[model samples]
Target: MTNVYLTARFPRIAFTKLETNGFTVDYYTGRDLISHSKLLRKVAKADFLITTLSTVVDSEIIDAAPNLKLIANFGAGFNNIDTEYAKSKGILVTNTPKVSTNSVCELTIGLMLALSHREVEGDQMMRKDGFPGWSPLYFLGHEIAGKELGIVGLGNIGSELAVKANALGMKASYFKPHQLSEDEEKAQNVTYKPFDELVKTSDFISINAPLTDENHHQFNAEVFDNMKDSAFLINVGRGPIVDEAALLKALKANKIAGAALDVYENEPVFDKKFTKLKNVILTPHIGNATVEARDAMAEIVADNVIWSSKGKEPKYVVNK
Candidate 1:
């Protein structure tokens, strides 16, 4: 029987599935994976390891797990995992992709609506009994209907956002490494534009690109300067894609109307300065955090463990 170690709490469905297959599973929850050195010591003997973004699986950690056959990530982004080091040791790494697309896309739209309408601010004011009477300019916000929306990437989440934006009477334009086909363009009603042009012409900009070496700090002072003064920015993608310092400056200087972010450069540890700004809406990286998405991701991780244990191909192998 294979022994599996879960570095963080996952959906119970995964544990039940693995147990049904005669695998011994042990997990620790409600503890910080980074700060807990004893947990990694226990992980050293496990045959399969299931992890979340909170945990780091580097060369030293992988070396500790000599019996490890697989490392299954319970989310789409495996940026936390050291894939090169894992592959060098012939350890299979897998991630759950496309499962959380709709949930994340929905959150992106939610952030856009909330930021544009000042939803959070309004809610807080109402709760504090500060809503005296309706005034002509009471919480006046940017209009979303028939506005130009620029998407940084046109992948699953970005494309879904495009569809939703179109339905809300917005024109969709995207900038990606590759161009979309004519059929795809017509279906989503997305026009491919140059990055610079998209930044300059858009009334609202939403970033859905992945974090890569080329895309790191993709949004900086120059890009913010090109945006319209009334433009709003929303990022549902990786944190490091936008330079944190540049974003703070842009928001403070009113270079753009406002910004909404679900991820940050140093996630789970936000910049102290961001809390002081009222123009920005921040979420604790809950893009793919829906209950359904979490369960689906857990099932994917379980499938990877089962498949790898049986010498079969996993559904979403990252190392391969």
Candidate 2:
């Protein structure tokens, strides 16, 4: 029987499934690993290591787990995992992809609407018990209908947002390395534009690209300068893609109208400046936190661990 280490808290169904597979599972729920020495001792014998975004699986941790044949990540983004190191050791790495596409896409649209319409400000005013008489100029915000939306990456979530944006009477444009197929292009009705041109001409900008070496800090001061002063920015993808300092400067100086972010460069430990700004709407990385999405992701993680333990390829192998 394979020895599995459950490094994070997961749904009971996933745990039950893993147990039924006749694996010896050791569970840990505390954010801290008790102690690095103790964790190294426990993982030294682990055959399959299952983790979440919070856990840092670095080279040192990998070296400690000599028996680790596979690493199953519970979420779609495996940026937390060191793929090259894992591959060199013949340890397969897998992530749950496409399972939370709808959940994330829904959050992206929600963020856009909230930021553009000042939904947070409106809610706060109502909660303050300050029900003053409504006036025409009271809390006026940008309208969503008949606006130009520029999407940075045309991946699954990006394409889905385009469809939703079109339904709201917004014209969709995207900037990507390659253009979509004719059928896909017609389905989304999005025009491909140059990155700088898209940033300059858009009424709203949405980023849904993965974080890679080539695209890190892609949105800096220069990119923000190109954006229209009336445009709103939304990011649902990885954090480091946008320079936080540059974004802060833009928001502070009113270089852009407003911004909404679901992820941050140094997440869970964000800059205090964002909290003070009313022009930005921030979320605690809950893009895929819906109950349905969590269940699906857990199921995928369980299946990946089971199959990989049996010497079979997983559904989403990162090192492949």
Candidate 3:
């Protein structure tokens, strides 16, 4: 029988799909991450391995799975899996792309609004200090309308964000290595700006790029220094894209007005100082945590595994 091993407990929809197709599925059900030794043991017997973004499938894990046919990642991002190495060993690697685009884009917009309007701080104040009476000058947060939103990636989520931002009365600009053509830009209602210019001018700068060898620590100390003093930073992308230490310094020094983040440089572990800052709002990487998005991703993962089982090439294969 074809066997599937999941590194973590995901939605039961995937297990149902796999079992209904006559595949035996097993997964780690612990709240914490699966231990490396247990992962090696389970993967050694798996024909198809389903991994989440938090599970690291390095060369050692790949090598241990002598019968491994596919690594179907449950998330849109596949940085946790070593695609090149998997391909070299004749193991197919796939990710559920576009499944989380709208969810993450919406979260990005939410973070932007929450940070700019001081929603988190206000909520805390209401709970701790009680209502100080409604006054025009009570919160004094900035409005997002008529503001410029600069996105640092023009992929699916970024493009979606641009469209949403324009609808919300915010002018959206983007910076990517490959600028979109004039027609494409017109279609999306976004203007292309150089990275430096976007950072220096926009009221809110969002990081929506994937993590790559060239883009680790893409936003560092210098980038923070270049941003407007009143600008806000929002990151719904991979955590390592920004230098967390530098961000801590900038927030403390008031280099920028504030920041809202869904990811951190070292995930599951971040600077405790950020928790104390009223200007910063942090989430536990819940960009795609919506029920609809997670269910869709689960279906995608099961579909990819089913395709591989039937000797068919999956549509979402990432490594050729």
Q: Say which candidate scores most in TM-score.
A: 3
Winner by lDDT between candidate 2 and candidate 1:
1
Residue-by-residue lDDT tens digits, candidate 1, 276-306: 8878898988999989999999999998899
Q: Total clashing residue pairs per candidate?
A: 0, 0, 0
Candidate 1 matches the true fold with a TM-score of 0.96
Q: Write candidate 2's Cα lDDT for 202-236 as tens digits.
A: 99998899888988999999999989999998888
Clashes of 2: 0
RMSD of each: 1.5, 1.8, 0.9
For candidate 1, the lDDT comes to: 0.88
Model 1 weakest 10-residue run by lDDT: 30-39
Residue 230 of candidate 2: its Cα lDDT?
A: 92
**Model 3 TM-score (2 dp):** 0.98
Which one wins on lDDT? 3
Q: How would you order the candidates by lDDT, starting with the best?
A: 3, 1, 2
lDDT of each: 0.88, 0.87, 0.92
- What's the candidate order when arranged by decreasing TM-score? 3, 1, 2
